[model samples]
Target: MGSRRTFSRRLGVPGRAGVALFAAGLGLMSPFAAAPASAQTADAPAGTWATPPPLGPGDAPPADSGHPDTTYKKKNECVQRSLGQDVKINFRPWGQDYLQLDRAQQIVRAATGSVGGNQKVAVIDTGVTPHPWFQDRVESGGDYVATPDNGAQPGMQDCDGHGTEVAGIIAGNPKDPQVGFIGVAPDARIVSYRQLSENYAKDDSPQQPSAPPSGGTGAPPSGGESQQPPAGGSSNSQLPPSSGGGTGSGSGTAPQQDNKGDSRDLAKQGTAGTLNTLAQIIRGIADTHRAGVINMSVDHCRPGTAPGDIQEGERKVQAAVRYAADNDIVVVAAAGNVSENCPQNDQADPNKPKSIVTPPWFSDDVLSVGAIQEDGGVAPFSVHGPWVGVAAPGTKIVSLDPAEHSNGLANLTIANGNPSPIQGTSFAAPYVAGVAALVRSMFPHMKARDVVKRLKATAQHPAAPGGRDNFVGYGVIDPVAALTANLPGDTGNLSLPKPVVQEAKLPPADGISSTPMIVALAGTGGGVAALLITLFVMHTIRRNRARSSPPTK
Candidate 1:
């Protein structure tokens, strides 16, 4: 059955037609493709040029699908330790872990003379906890969701652990030097926006007596699709009938009783709701003139299959991205999670190539970050297409996990908590976002285009047919090069002088005559005018002096 399944599975671009067309188009259009390798100087590693198979992390296996009636409480437990602030962790081989980051830091430190002093980054994902990793590192960016008043509600906190993991990568600070984590920017502040609601539908609803505590990790993988909460199950009295259309009043709500239903209920797309909330936050940021970066670790793809045109949600997102750019804000989004397929198979219509980050990465204004493996290769599970701006570390990456899944251990707190190694393009995006904040901090007046250009120019190209590959864009981001790279932005308005026409011949003495008439006449007129004015002024002064002297006498 397995052999037949493998044989039956169609791979590569559907047929050779697509490949032939793409190659022909490239030959006719791409100037870089024709440029000689020696002239270009840099290159990606040599490999047979092959279109990587469409891939995705797809559905996790049945064994990994189920979740506990309640989330694991230990996952949320913070481990307090007496370790000092600056300890080196042997998280990986010392040579690999610290060498690159330390070197990069040194370069940035030398360039800027400090970590970002007071720049804020909005982590638009699951809420971050008050850990030392984020100690003195966050401001109360109001929670966007109204029903869930506090961080305890869904979309107010992290339940799946994806957002928390990404946060730590961008800003975690573990106490243990030997076996914990340190973020890319420890001092930079974070504003958490819980994009994914915590009260995601679960399969089982534990009764009052049986309901597990808030911070408990439920039994691992009991069956297919974890326990889901019923739609409109929790506190309907506090929530509006439809969380769409218009803004609802934000009122305080309490912990609702545990009620379980299908997981699909949680998958509802409130594009309007999400965009409205995002707009409000962005407006606030702009109104206050707060210059910072917006870190988006989530992205949806092009919508429309057997239906009408794409939804307004995508448009709203595009507008928000444009708003961020126009307001001098840096917007960063994840390339996306990849299952094993080449392009993701749209659950809506598996037959078409209908997938990539939504609004095509909000019209490419936002920097779309892809995932790279430990070997600096594109992660097998990373979705790659034209939208990719750059690649960053996204493999078995260790970062902050929520307390419910952090497992009472501090070391585990920094480790990838999920079953299949919490690696995705989501984590990679924040690394770049942190770097952007660093760039904005150093070059306060830099625009979005300037930041993007410098990042690409200074990126360390991966070894290959190697300039910018679809998979890794320009290549891994070089923080050191970025900080020191002299990429210039728009320098407002300066006019250049026109070139003078120096003639080979003087034409004639007539040309000289014309020049003499203008010059001599102008000089004589100026001299006569100056003499008359001087005499008149002297006479008037003498008369006034004589009258004043008589009076004085």
Candidate 2:
């Protein structure tokens, strides 16, 4: 009977037009057809010029998706050890080199005495773990991703090591010489806001049973989709295998239960409340009036989508950005690791071409950062568009790691330890944020808008067309320039020259017109003589008249 059913299914193949219609219905055909010739090149390398893979279970939602996209390099492939005894003590991350931090430090010291001193930087990500490097400077801003079961205290813990890495990049102090990694702004204070949950959705709602494809039986497949473990954690090996049992010999078979309901509930428990929670937290930060810069290394990139109209969640984030801006807080966000345009919302909307992503795309007030390689080229995975404000060193960036693994084991191996190196726009945003802190520290009276303007104006324009392309925006951030360079603000006025009073120049002696001068002088003298003669005649007449008048008196 099974063989007969399979044979019958094989006889019902769809025509080419039917296949085309199905592809169009899914909105897949247009993206491929409309893709540029460069993207469609058959000879292109495997990972280059390709759309990023779809988001998976371990990934955060679109709001906090600024985590590294490891399509180019696997997580294990990018690991590095902390500097050892024989290693040089002055080892610096490529990002620091790109920003010219040494020169910036000298300039900053000459001007402000220290780098990012007394400035508060708020890192909004997974909670930062307490590490020796940031022990004295780290402050808790409370966890926004807390669930009923997990409570809010765990929000301060770095379950996935992402937040710790980001915070370390911004302001990890160089206290431990053994771990020779230093943040861009070593003296800056860090305030952590834990917003992303450590776990992913466990199960998805089941699809209705459909007819089996050719050569397959009607029985449902065993097991659900495999879940990848979150970064820096081991896999969950205890999850039960999906039920696929059947009954025999007239015994009725009980249908296998699905975890769809449980999955939905878990998702609600974890992420349903994130948008409002994040918005409130941002407002709270602004209300504090302490944070000089807020480093939001998170971004949302919808899968299989082009940039489209704004969604409600994105609008809420934009409002929060506006709130931060209104309160004089500089907000810096990742440009996302997805290699599409910014502001990609709906994958199914054919009218929307690939563009920039939001909340950075939503407002020019926000600084949207892209990633660049050591050679100063845009990283293949860095998202691009007009909304991007600047690029930073994101590839192979070395920073702090969580102190321990989720299993309570120390997060150290013989080959590598706490100074874990990562790469993404996530880390890139912090570099810019650190620079912003330095700017704010140096110019305490400068407004948030002026600080943002200084960062962009002093950025090193790349060698691309227009000097500012969609890939790297204005170009890689120059920390020294941001610190020392004089930049114009949004309302920067030109310094006009003062009005000058010029004395009239006399002609050379040989070039003077002597004839006209003599004529003028002689005419003046003749006129004066005539006047004198008339006056004398009048006086004589008056004397004779006076004599006559005296006789009459």
Candidate 3:
């Protein structure tokens, strides 16, 4: 490939260009730079390295908010994107059309059936745009990327233009005429948490000089184990772990080729997102009771690393997922997409993917989703792993545009001024989240674990052994089935009324009298009489034959 500009959303989709080499004067390179097989880049967008302008007089957080009052040290700023290709309002996205959400909604009766029916789903990604398609369903949860520093309201700005796309898939409800576009659960309210962003990057200044002289770069491990970047810097590196805590130098919005003749863009966008941050955000969601479901489309990925080498950040994310499940919150995450920095898991054993995408890797507590193309096949870029729970439509995505003060929708994102269809596992995760919201709404008392199981059971299972593979898991999600289907041994959390054992009412079953019963039995005696007569004749013949045939040896 001429320029490897991978733009798939977080293990990312939109707006990434070439590899983000170490900036001058930074005196450090990507931790993966020395890996002959891998490229080093965070999943940030395609912005030139421009630090946010110097902090103004009041830009500093109030002293009461914290203890330290240090000078504002500038870092490499990436001018984030806020615009997307404006699509016609009447246009219907193929993903929603295929899901048949309206049928699911009717069955669930989210708006009309019960009090507090609209389930709250939290989107922990770039902040969601306040698109009109949301119809005031968006709520600001928190902003880790742009907050006290930038003075942007918490969870209100989508600098990377990625979170808005994710949220729209979960709750967008455009009431325009003849519009087929609607969310998996239109009534499900969205709680937006700007947990990560490609706009912000870590300041690995020369003063820190944390990197060793030999540059301490290590290639991904070839062993059958998962890998994730450390918490210090570089984004979640890639999947299996949740959004990484500290991101390294961001990758550009360009496509990179894994081998030869490959056309799918797999460049991950850089963001402030990291695994530890992701873990923190998940726990926060459970603590605050903000939402019943969590959607994480961002992930930290690294080239395969040493066997049995688990990053602390990945463990934290795993704990967070368990916490969410314990608190009855359903957590859904993207099975990270493929890129040069993050290779496919095809070479690994069925259960052991060298590339571990998180919180998806923490599968028991999470519902990891893989991406599928429009034709119902697995998207080539959707990374494969055993943790994947189900698949959803990910290719050629259409969702709310993340631009500021705009109510338009978008089907494509611009990279290097060229429009490419919005596509990625990032988008797919939201689809599952939307379905999860609907399931939560319909079965208000179902346990979070049961909800996860329901999704797997209702999916369009693959033909692979055990009805799943590393790629598509249990297969594509069936929203309608998820909402209404009854499962065997479903005692997980249906919360149905207990069955009451009681004696039957006094009216006895009518029956024939004994005389009539005898007649009924006698009515069938003719066949018996015929059989007896035949037996008598056979006995007479046998007696004569016995007399004639004496003894034969």
Candidate 4:
């Protein structure tokens, strides 16, 4: 893979890359580039990259918004809010209404707790906080963003609420009647992997640095404006005791005002470094053998670029996904929140080849999910394309909230203490992931591909032109059907079907004849007989004349 430039797109935020890394000052190095001969030896780790010096304040890359900022008003409000003279209050959690939770509950009850027993789902996103609703189901895998000198914390800590929300949807306990929030796979276990940094949302100032570094010669580069994180994080609710604080990297800190001279230079380094770090994290996840299904609600987009163009960072991620698939781990990702037809045209460059967002578009092995509304229509912001595997409810999804109000941002209070309603494909992907956990738990013998096939085969088709269309793919997933129905070719044996051989019918013994051939043969015989008769008559006439008077001549 040549080093191709790429962009990221947030799940909920429109028109912005989900995760942006800038290597403006530092040369853009490929995260998966082969190390020099001097750096490698037979004893070294198989996939280790040459370690660069720990980034300092001067080297801190500027953070881009990878996770959606939950502080803002949710795109589509799940809970209805009542307006009083002075106070606004949220009434109830309406996610159940749109999700048709009763149907899912009925299926679970019938199954008698047979679903999601020991199935392990790896959530690769922001860190997930262990909420009371989880009931000790959430497990810490490791933090990939932390370095020894970056003041980063270990374990899964969601400074932004994205990871916790996604985990809640996948495995939050349904037994918590007080909270009234139920996860699709309530019994499933969650393994959290913090692939993104805590300060993923921070942005640098746009103005160029006023001065060069104290010892350096050149002026610092200008920085881009900060964008909001994608959709589907816990609103600015308080972080629970179980929910750890920020990764302790300078993530929570506001952009510096006095360090204008080196801010841009540092921000670019940070951004570029983050990409390399993310690739490493994905590779680590692939190496973990215990993970059954990996839910990645993150998406990358290069605004104004075609979809199929593979970027260097994206190539590394794709390779990681392939590694996971080879290990029998199923990977599910968001289809992105952009409204365009993915892997299609780039109106920005009409003549360029159609390309799609990364990770989800990386391979067929990755199950890419799109968002659908309560009315069984595709979400307005949901990205549509041939790559979408299935659709799930993403609009106004109500899930767990962090207990401590650390950020003091926008917090909506629903039942179960600050549970907020979020909407995006980020939330949609987890729905499928939860169902995938159920399938894996029930059918432990099935391969990853067979599991995905069962899910798609059992999905409920919407009333579209075709049973399956690009907008919703195979339509919204039917959890009950997926769990109970026996799909075609689902037998454990991997043998191919026997070829059906039809016996050929032989022609009649006399031989076959066509009307045109028979007519032509009869015509030829009649012509020959007429010519012979004419010649005989002429010969007879000549003989009679010779005998009468022409005998002498």
Candidate 5:
């Protein structure tokens, strides 16, 4: 009923005690409560605060209760342009000001002035429209959702509005003077890949035949919840923390026990998206040199599986990410938003995450990113995990609209015809991706691993002693510092102070003479005692005199 129902688009936190606590502090409505951005008023009392309700484009209504057939159909169609796909703004969004990108840009401009001019970032999610902000920088890598017409660009059309926004965060450069929000790397190039979309899901009857496509634990946040996937979300195979796992962005609705047989089979056959396609997509990006960095805001989430029971599709994804890393490409992805389907990874042990979201769970090869609010706290909907490499401003998003006609920036998206603000880690991954671009541009010779390490090292680490935590990892990213900070990895990093050698010295000895001290102590004590004795004798004599004279009284 809301904006385009997208499986790749996550909503908010679960409807648990955590949401209630978060709402009580903020004076929000029920966990299930959701409102459009237009519903909020700026005129709340001075001491109070007002904000938009969490908007989840992925929250789908329940599927049919009837026994659905396992032989589901898959098709491809172009995502049509929509009227409310974007909301224009004459001012900058909080994220830009929060990160202070303008100042960072100024600093970099004065030095290398390489604001990603030589960088290319690949966005694998819903397709991106050719927005005005992109100018001539947006490119079509390929499409998994819709079969391209002979002349149409496969990955140029964005129906879900997800990938377009993600790319905007990385490379949008508007011509307008009034709009303050521009891409982090305004000069960088963007390659769009449409790998997932809700619009291309099930139909009562099969229409035109086409090819198929792919693909925290901190506490329960307020808006994220497990809504039924728009297309069938059930999976035939899934594993748990200790054993292994499957791949998808988030988990699907567990089929009810009574309907398990039919629902499970139907889910397996459901044509939502697949990890197999996601794997292929990454390999495609790596092999063709389409981009040096990849932003995958979309992930595969499923119920945990046994420790050693990794699925075939998941193994392929793991191998593909490894392959990318070996080729010296940086992969950045969302940490995931918490909900019933996808549990938070708040466990003390890193490996024993309550839920596993891959590419992210594959921490060594991927730079998993978490979302933080404008206030800098981890977003309530942002799920915590050991794999989180860094955090960025994910809420109160302002970016170019994917609608081909809108050609403007948006702070609000249409959810059920109501204005809803864009908030999710889906957008957060791009911030790091954008920063990665800036880093690679600044240091042309830096390797991919070092780039990942630099971003983490330059990040504002958490309060934890290790400078990292499950919640925010190394902490919120500082792009200005990332561009300018010197590191051990820097070959010319001689700015560090040289070690100073010091002569070892013994403890100071007591120097005063004991004889003088003893004499002074003896003299002082004798004088006091003599004075007391003299006073006692005098008092005795005076008492005797008074006794003789007391007869008269």
Candidate 6:
């Protein structure tokens, strides 16, 4: 965790002594940074932080206006008390896996019957927003935070760029076709679960910047109320109402922006409750067998020796994943973006062991994904773990970011777009999840366990291993290899043929001269003339006999 070097891929060669590299400049920073928990790094490029277009009084459209679903109202009310999007933070890109991602996609198409036909794949992460990639891609799963009254909607609006970016990777279609960074199965449906909506997406909570940090030691809240902070704490900040018009810093003047639904009572410990509700919804989907695959790009890091504690909220959430799998759904997760300084029993923790990811205790069904560099090496930021199942492209990987509609595929290649270069395990998990959908699409009847086996078996080994590596588990998932590699076809349908009829013909009369029938008839007529003369003689004899008999009488 000492020397920092920028490798082409996020996770570089596994055993080559990884130097934990932190890209705080990108939107992703260590959880321990001193800045406001919601603050984006100043190092991010101009466009990401470029003043969002002057949001007029009606500029930031109401979350429920155009959508027919009523769930928007419920979710908006639930998250109104939290911090909203801060103009200062730089929105990070999903990073540089575009080329490899494209290749992987091709392989999926060749293998799967069709790219995820109408199947909904839900990504439960920080809130997501509508981007060109997903402009028409999402359907409402209900905004869990924006309005709390209901729990379903069509648009997956992202206030924080994180969730939207992850969703885009899972199912985004680029505006510019010239740059091919389309998702693995762009046609597949997407469900956005607003899990990381707290400080990240909608934290209107009064910020007493001067208050001391408690490091999350407070007791869990009782009942479904917002838990109030200890006494002497300042109240939550009131966000300037959203403005409809004006540019730069001036956009905060609008009145409607401030009316972002109703605030929840802070006395209730509602974060956990909110999560439980989200989990129940997910479990319900699994029970109904709705989504073919579910991608969770969010993870809670737990310290060593803390046997069962991982965010009291996460413990409940992971159980939901198990429940989903019991009903035959596939759950995929990010290992985490905390590889830079993974703290171990007090030393630099250089054992290069499996202490990185969470829900970390082995879950056979969960496919823990670690990030890898373009050179087929482990990304510097990727967390390693024993539970790791496979790897996908996660370095400087290009993906959809909702905050700035600027395209990642185009921005990465060109210099002009608000290029906030990004890297993390968040980008990696979707690639695999998308591929999993492809696998399921092609082999619709294959069990989740069988699909896992095919993915592992098809994965090609990278330059550094006899088998699986700590950095690139089973090597960067070879989509072409994974999809085409000995996949047995499903035998659910077979078409039988109908019976056929044949006509018959008689051979020409045996030896009748083989001439015309008229000629044959004329040849037989000469024989009939001789028979006529014989009949005349017999007639004359009968007449003479009759005359003689009359005389005798």
Candidate 5 lDDT over residue span 1-553, tens digit each: 2332331134354435444555554533321122222211101112211111121354222221211222223332222222322334667777888888998777666767557888999998767778777888988887765554324487776644567778999999985677778999998999988676543455556565544332200000011211111111123322211111011122232221110001111012334445666777888777777799999887765555545445556666777787788788999988777655666666555445566666676676788888888888888778776567789988777777554455666554332222235677877889999999888877777888888878877888665634566778777889988888877646332254556998899889788779998999999999999999999999999999988885764
**Per-residue C-alpha lDDT of model 4 across residues 328-372, encoded as one tens digit per residue:** 888898876652223333234222324355566543557888887
Cα RMSDs, all models: 24.4, 22.8, 19.0, 17.4, 18.5, 25.8
**TM-scores across all candidates?**
0.57, 0.57, 0.65, 0.56, 0.65, 0.54
For residue 297, model 1's alpha carbon misses the true position, in angstroms, by 1.0
Candidate 1 lDDT score at position 246: 8
Candidate lDDT values, in order: 0.47, 0.53, 0.59, 0.52, 0.61, 0.47
* Candidate number with the higher lDDT (4 or 6): 4
Question: Per the 3 Å backbone cut-off, how many clashing residue pairs does candidate 6 have?
Answer: 66
Off by over 4 Å in 5: 1-87, 149-151, 202-271, 347-350, 491-553
Model 3 spans > 4 angstroms off: 1-86, 110-117, 148-152, 204-271, 491-553
Q: How far is candidate 1 from the true structure (C-alpha RMSD, Å)?
A: 24.4
Best by lDDT: 5
Scored against the true structure, residue 220 in model 5 reaches a CA lDDT of: 8
lDDT of 6 by residue, 86-161 (tens): 2221223333343255556665566554467656788766455555556566766654444321232433544333
User: lDDT at 49 for candidate 2?
Assistant: 18
Error of 2 at 450 (Å): 0.9
Model 6 bad stretches (over 4 Å): 1-113, 148-155, 198-278, 306-314, 339-356, 360-362, 404-420, 462-466, 487-553
Candidate 3, residue 481: CA error in Å? 1.2
Residue-level lDDT of model 1, residues 147-219, one tens digit each, is: 2323343333443344555566665655456643566765677776654443333223354223224432221
